[model samples]
Target: METRQEAVTGTIGCATAVLGAFAGIAVWFPYGRTALFGAFEGETNPTDLWLGLPVLALGGAATAVAVLTAVQGRRRIAVGLAAATAALAAFGYAFDVLAAPQALQDCGSPC
Candidate 1:
């Protein structure tokens, strides 16, 4: 007897988890030296590798939980997880947009 809302939330949560995982991987294995390059594209920086690894792990875990909860008919939990994931995604994207220019400016080419 799962509600439609719960199903939707579960789906969203799963999507968010996937997105987060990708973002985390990108951060950890950046293709470029600067965050700006990596933000929009697939760039990696050795120095920041450590920082991104944890995010990747967390994203994967969250995604797993969301999927499990959804499957178990825990609609409320799934929805909450999805909402949180959406919020995090939104904030991360915003930060990338706002921070890109600054990162580029700081690095000054070859970034």
Candidate 2:
């Protein structure tokens, strides 16, 4: 049985996780697309460390806290958050490890 406080915490955690995941995806989308397709399109997409690095760091922190909260009291929400967080983490990883590098490479000497 979950107390009211626990329920509220879980709810907030779930919501935060969802929002964080959405935010992560939102931030990654443009860069990811540019990195993946810009070269072929004859356009150079440069990675913005200023914007991307902070968002990824913050989103990661938020997701970690949310997952901890959900695991403490809400099994159902935990599962959902786990999936969402996984996707967010994977997407972030791809953006950082693969996409960013590709984008940088595409930039040549001027980026």
Candidate 3:
């Protein structure tokens, strides 16, 4: 049987890991697709690049902080913040992915 401390640590670790993984996917999945297939021709909207890179950095920072705090048992607030950050990044990536189609559709050939 797991002790109380062990159980708590295990739960925290699991949550932190899941949060971290989702955060990674949130950022990577969108950008990875662009990298794999190449950007749309005449795609000049810099918004995706501008938005994605920062969130990935923020998510990374949050994940690091969450894992550290969870391990030390000094704070749960950081873990909560990390989860929120991950969710926000996921939403942001989804937004960018969804918007890409519309953005491309709006571009016209002027030449």
Candidate 4:
């Protein structure tokens, strides 16, 4: 017998986690080589794809867990997933901001 507040909170947390995961994935994967070229005007590295795939998978799992917890009305679990999503999102952003530029730099012109 969960309270309405708990249910609402759980739903909100799940939504937050889902959105965060999507954002993290976007930053991690970008849009293949074309998108990378449009943004940074350089050759994209295969190594980046290797590194980002695992992060995207982990974020996807976190989002799924959040959704499941919300559906089950598990407020605490939903909240924990939401917090993990936030941390992952932050880490993804930091990795993109710091690592992306260096990788692009390595591409040189016409990358």
Candidate 5:
């Protein structure tokens, strides 16, 4: 039987690893660009406000559930679920096509 401490540690470790992957994807993925080219399409990246944030939120929820289960004495299952949660975040926008660096040109700043 696993102790509360051990289970919690495992869950956190897995969750943290997922979050690390999330950070890497965010830094490298294009957050701003034209989703489609057209005269009135304007410039906007729907992936940001739509896709990325939601998956992160879902992962957070899964992490929360994992912690909850860990405290209940189901460490192994909790760890697996927590890892799955984190993976869900990566599924969001992490694998999208990379756009030209100049398209958005540093979204938060002037390109």
Candidate 6:
């Protein structure tokens, strides 16, 4: 049986993680992908930077919280949420590297 405080922490952590994941995915299509690739090539878009910053910040914060919850609660659900949060945070980079190599190369100023 979990205490109320533990439950609350788990809930907040889960919600934050979900929100962060959603924000990351939502921005990735319109701004994140191009922004990220452009950054690699020294041609970042202002719009992408503006949009990506907050999303990345949220994801980082959420991941931290989820990890904290998992460690503090020592519960299976909390652990699962932490793992899911981490995976979601990594999904965009994975997609870019594995599935969108051509797209990345196409972005940024002509060489």
lDDT of 2 at 103: 39
lDDT of 2 by residue, 1-111 (tens): 889997997687677656765766566666656654555535544554444545564565467665675667767766775676677567657656325444355566765
Query: lDDT for every model?
Result: 0.56, 0.60, 0.62, 0.63, 0.58, 0.58
Range of the 10 consecutive residues with the lowest summed lDDT in candidate 3: 97-106
| Tens digits of per-residue lDDT for model 4, 11-53 | 8766766775676566555544433444454545454465565
User: Model 1 over residues 13-105: C-alpha lDDT tens digits?
Assistant: 677667757655665444223542464344434333333355444655565667667887989998887776666556545434223323444
In candidate 1, stretches whose alpha carbon ends up further than 4 angstroms from where it belongs are 1-56, 97-111
The lDDT leader among the candidates is 4
Residue lDDT tens for model 5, 9-87: 7787667656755654464444433443311225545545455545555565567667667887999989898789768
Number of the top-ranking candidate, with TM-score as the measure:
4
RMSD, one per candidate, in order: 8.6, 7.6, 7.5, 7.0, 9.1, 7.7
Ranking by TM-score: 4, 3, 5, 1, 2, 6
Q: Estimate candidate 2's alpha-carbon lDDT, on a 0 to 1 scale.
A: 0.60
In angstroms, the error of model 5 at 103 is 5.5
lDDT tens digits by residue: candidate 3, 25-101: 57565664564344666344445555655556557556765766766776777769677777966867676632453
Q: Flag clash pairs in model 2.
A: none
- Flag regions of model 4 displaced more than 4 Å: 1-30, 33-42, 97-111
Candidate achieving higher TM-score, 3 or 6: 3
- Model 6, span 8-99: residue lDDT tens: 87797777667766655564555556565654545655544554555465665566566666677657766665666566557546443223
Output the lDDT of residue 68, model 5: 64
Winner of 2 and 3 under TM-score: 3
Instruction: Tell how far residue 77 is off in model 4, in angstroms.
Output: 0.8
Relative to the unseen true structure, what is the C-alpha lDDT of residue 80 in candidate 3, on a scale of 0 to 100? Answer: 97
